[model samples]
Target: MELTITSQKKTIQANVLQLHLYQQSKVIEAMDKRNNYYYVVFYQDQFINVVKPTHMKRHSHVQRAITNGISLPGDHPLVNKLIGQQTLSMTRFNQLFKKLQQHYPPLETALILSFFDSFTTAGSIPKLIKKTYYDFRRNGKMRKALQALYLLKEVDAQNTFANDLIGKMEFQKYNEAYQTLDIIMEKDPVYFEDICFRHLQDGIYHENLLMFYDQKNRHIDAIMVLLYLLKQQFNETHWQQLQATIQTWNNEAQIIVLSDLYRDQPHPIIEKELTGRLIGSSHHNEVVSFLLEQNYLPTQTEMDKIIDHLNHTDRSQLIQYFHQSKEKFATLRQSITKNQLEKAITPFIKAFLSTYSFEEINQWFRAFHESNELFLIEQTIHTMEKLQDDPDHQDKLGELYASLDQVEQAIDCYKWEMELHPQNTKAIQAVAHLYKEMGNETEAGTYQDLLIQTQKYG
Candidate 1:
């Protein structure tokens, strides 16, 4: 049978999820603004059914019946018999569960009562949970101290000479614990890492934290830790060791770990490490990406290397680098082939057009034309036109099309130039010449006469 609900009031509201019994269902303890309760099952933005309780009935009993009816997954059919069977009164619903609790649900009233009671005391739950939290934290610290003590014994066993120093460490007055741990860290960084887990989060910063993760292994982290550490501490020896350790992991993990290192601390060494790994992994053109992400300004030598790489074959990488780092890339120009320019996105193309001189721009235009990359040639010309760097762009575009024997496109370019600059002798002559060449003598003669009139009058 279908379910139905009735209310003379236009609006009704209910609280939800405040009790765990109905936390996962739409069942709610609905009420109106006057706190007049509705003993109802609500679903799909509407109340489906309700049974009005007795005049003096406890609101909690009906609310509990509505919420607990569906909370039981295994006893769903039985609970439905008591609570959801059309208009079961509050007195009969409570009697059904109470009288049958022995054979079925087999749960005490205290269990149900406690489940509901906990929500009634929601404000105190966090306090109850945290009452022993400090003791737990103190216990954790004691465990860490014991772990360090055990490791220190291992360190002492490894060297007979430090037994006296280690033994004196028990006395805080002359222990010099920091100095002792620093020596242990310098001797074995992994032990130092375990001794100082989470590093500074554990409230200690070892002089050898970099060495700890370095021993753990990385290319960029090793380098960044070098950057973070005293530059005086890094000689060729440390770098070579770091490099050797990083080279040991596969390229993919190196990419991931170094990518993390780059995100965490983006120094030039990390950049080189990540870029080299990315390139080695056939990640064709991402060398410029970290610079974009980190807004890095590569030094002159780094810029030269990128430009040199472009000349060799990584064109997309080079243009993006120059585009994103325009200030550092100023005063430097790199030759680009038509193939490289064809692969460029519009933003990089725009940037490239702004910085390159006319000669370099024309070279790629001709290259695109040679390779039949006419669209790119047009884009380059259009980008140049927007920048308005060249006063004779219309003539240049006309010349490019005419070179390729695309006389219709060429004539269109010249005619547009004539329309914009009516006295432009080159445009008028080129249009007239092209029209005459196409055997359209009427149009050609009209343009030829206009050209003669302008030249003669001036």
Candidate 2:
């Protein structure tokens, strides 16, 4: 029968030492795999040498292997070097060869040669292999052949030696993995879920996460269950229960649990909750709409609190509210800033400029400019566009443009305003004043001509 290990159904209780050792070994192995090729031996507190396969380059054979997926027959120099070394153990030598086979293709000759330099007179084979295994595992390579011996009881399993080996391991590796997994989960929830699903069979996957959600320490089971449901594409009803469960878990100061799960299974629930809260306030619709566009799902109560603060509070209250809930308010505040400026012109035009007359809308624009509201700014600009035909409105537009520091556009608007009221001395003088400021002698002369004509006509 095939062995099936499901974390949910089975208890993954590992002994403290064994769990620590197994984890430490994984760390050392990972390091060896990525960095140095050989396991290092230290003698008298000094680095002795590395133990790795040694083979002289045999190009003709290598080229043949590349082309055919099999090496061509050639004399392996390592085998010849090892034949003279009668001190080499055939048992250990053979074991090394099999281990190399698991990663690289056949290289029996090189394995024997590697042993001539690599092997040291360690007290016990199992203890030595365990030490070497941890070293290699930490370094990031599979010393599976040596590892298999330990598992198969081919090597010694004495606690005194094994425990000594385990204690020597660098805790940094385990700590680093925990930190790394934490970061990966926090930054990307979907990726976390993928990792969990990919390694579902490995009890160690649960073991690693259990650091954050250990029942005896701080139970985050409900949060994990919620995240698992999200990972499994749990429907609305399940998500609702998960929400309740998470709230209960939250009461225990266990945010790490939620954070871990979020890193693995970021879903659309956040935006959904925010939208529910945003509908309560008409002004907040812009904020809600922005969140919706970004596909953000704020938690329900979080959104409700935001809406309540924004709609019913004084300026001091608003500042205090956001200051206290920085995480939730950060995105909302940013969205407000972006939308405020943009919403003003577009929505204002739709609200007033399309149907309202210039004179009638001027008071609204004044209120908008005084308020410095983003929606009102857009509306004032739109209202100005509607009054393009009126001399007073045109002068107001010119003043508005000048106040905004669009000097060139403001000058143009002043000229246009003069054209609308050629008889008005102030309008004609304003054009001449702008032309003079701009150092446009020719344009200034033209404005002089307009002023003369306006004075004569009036």
Candidate 3:
């Protein structure tokens, strides 16, 4: 019976760490590598050192293995280095060589797995390896000799055989054999890409193929696969895999991918995460725009985060979001710092004047005045002056001016109201009262007389 890779996982899980100690027992490529070689360790299919991958290139061998497929010959120096160590002449290990020759014309993946199964320690079965090498040479089966030679090496051999199998195995055959997450976890990420490329050849896609790219941390390829999955009929398992993959990334990494996901579809998970990431991220303008475009309103606190970082260019988006949102802005006012409110003042005023009742804007300005935000009140009055210029409604501007103690401006607005409607007693009285308050007795008596005349005419 052939061993299924998933069913016998404990044996697979504890294989040699694949990092080798090199040049004075310092671990290097295919081992617990440190500074000496360019070893890329992965977790959840993503590289452990993503930020400075180029900085890792001290040796070309590992980079080459990762970029270009590995296919080492029997006499390669790396191969020789691998088998140089000694081990017992074990019968079981030698049988691996027989299985390879018997199945040599088309070496099977099951036979390939046996090599890893027999593996015990470094050089654990080199005696069998040497016998196999000599037998293959004697039998003139040099390629099988190389396959025997590969048994001494671990990851590189798995990589080499997997590359060869790509050319020979049908895609589904390879996918059936190796696409399981447990099986994928143990193999080189490059092999997974090869199989994905094969699957793409037919223009047929499965969201589950994300396992090859997403789980393996094949960054560029992962994006293409993720986009495809986004377009397919929604699948919970597919989305869960995508979410789990993103959960591993740093905020910076998450933002770039999430932006792409958001563009392709408006899933709530995508919108929520993209909204969160874009705010404090370098893409703050995006957060503002994203919030505006989204149907679900962000809480006042969430909007304030963007307001705190507001730049001149994003103000328009803020204005767009604020349209008709008085209650939201009112809540934002209590917690917004002075500087943040200042930065967002233009948008806030535009929103208020556009949606606020004529009386409501004056009340809002009074709240600003009480807070000692005189500048904000002035800005609102200025915007209202340009946008809501109704001669009949000078009372609104007069009230704001009076609240600010701009008595002369308040008197001028009330006088304008008196001129626009001579029969209006309230504006004439307001003018007389403000003049008296300003100690201008002449203007006070003049407006008081004008008020009496207007009332007499009415």
Candidate 4:
């Protein structure tokens, strides 16, 4: 006869043929012809083979029968006997599972074992769950392994061994892995520390750890890890990656984290990484001060970068720091343009002009003249007169006087140039022109004769 078993939304069709039982009772085993196996043994409407199927193939049929569909009644004696038993002997558990295997599917067997596994804290359940976990993992069944891991966690949430397994599985799922690691850290900090140190050493999940720390509001820890990584690896690419992470933080956090790093007085490579970033930041003045107070001088390029970001007040403060180290004067000189120097005209020009050779200062004055910086021109002329006595200086002064329409002053400067260098043709010719402009034909003719005599004599 064909029997149809329906349970929940699933239906299974099996042909039940009577087979005589070997024992004395009037019993017959109902074999599913389709499966070629006895699903149940019955005597007077009672099931003798109460053991469920263990193999995967027969789970469907066995499940339907067990669910009040066909094979056994809900309150049957065998059913009550199986339900009342809290724990099974290992031999009995194995036997039942084996017999069920001849009739049910693997999944059903796992479910049965898992149910029993939940009730007992000892015996074969733990081993069976572990085997199941590995089996699923070996078959690339990640979800199944995850389910087993969840069960494992239930049994021992603080089990480092179990947490390790869970962490391994969850690592592939970032959020889940983070949660798992968090739990591990809370329950077993030392173990988590070891795990983290190992992964960091192995260069595994370095970025994930950084992000995890940041997400947990552990900015200092994250920066510490980053610095440690950079110290170990010390490559441009990784430094750039580290910098990108630093960029994500607020200015206050950056200051706190980076200040701690700076305090360590790290290797130059790492120090540059720390200070280089700060040099471009709004906190540049503070960083500059920090470096200076530490006697850790920045290179000129680094100082320039810091100064570029400073406001006028902060810039002056930084420049003052530069003044402390005479080596920084070059940087100060670079920053002092004509306009900037013109602002503090007297002292700055005195200081600026004090540093160069006469030739260098003359060249600078010529540049000022070319750019039509008349204030610098007049100031330079006045400063040079007080400071030097040179024919070139006098000739430049005469040219400046003429450019400013100071005719008599031009005559005086040119005559001085002529006296200082008797064969100064340019200055002599300049004096002649100044005299002609003053309508003094006699003085003009005399200098003209002197110029012709000098030129003819040479």
lDDT of 4 by residue, 193-277 (tens): 4356446755544665655566565443454456656555555665665567677766555555455544553556656656766
Q: Give one digit per residue, the lDDT tens place, for model 3 in 122-229.
A: 433444454665676688865455444443333334445434533443333434535453454354333333344435423333333445445544443344444555
Screening candidate 3 with a backbone cut-off below 3 angstroms (N, C-alpha, C), the clashing residue pairs are 18-30, 18-31, 19-30, 19-31, 19-32, 20-31, 45-215, 45-216, 45-217
lDDT of each: 0.45, 0.39, 0.48, 0.50
Q: lDDT per residue, candidate 1, 1-458, as tens digits?
A: 11223444333343222111221112334344555654443321222234343342222433444444322222222222223445322233345336435532221222222222222333232232222223433666432332333333432234332344335433343233334667656543334544453342222453355555545443333343343232323344544554565566667656754565456456567667666666455443455465355655444545444443333444345454553443322212233343333333233443454356545545544433433446554565655345443445767777765654457767877877777788889888888898998999999999899889999995
Candidate 1 backbone clash number? 0
lDDT of 2 by residue, 27-60 (tens): 0000132242222221111222223334323322
lDDT of 3: 0.48
Cα displacement (angstroms), candidate 3, residue 434, comes to 28
- What residue runs in model 1 are displaced by over 4 Å at the alpha carbon? 1-195, 198-241, 259-281, 290-325, 331-347, 350-458
Clashes of each: 0, 28, 9, 12
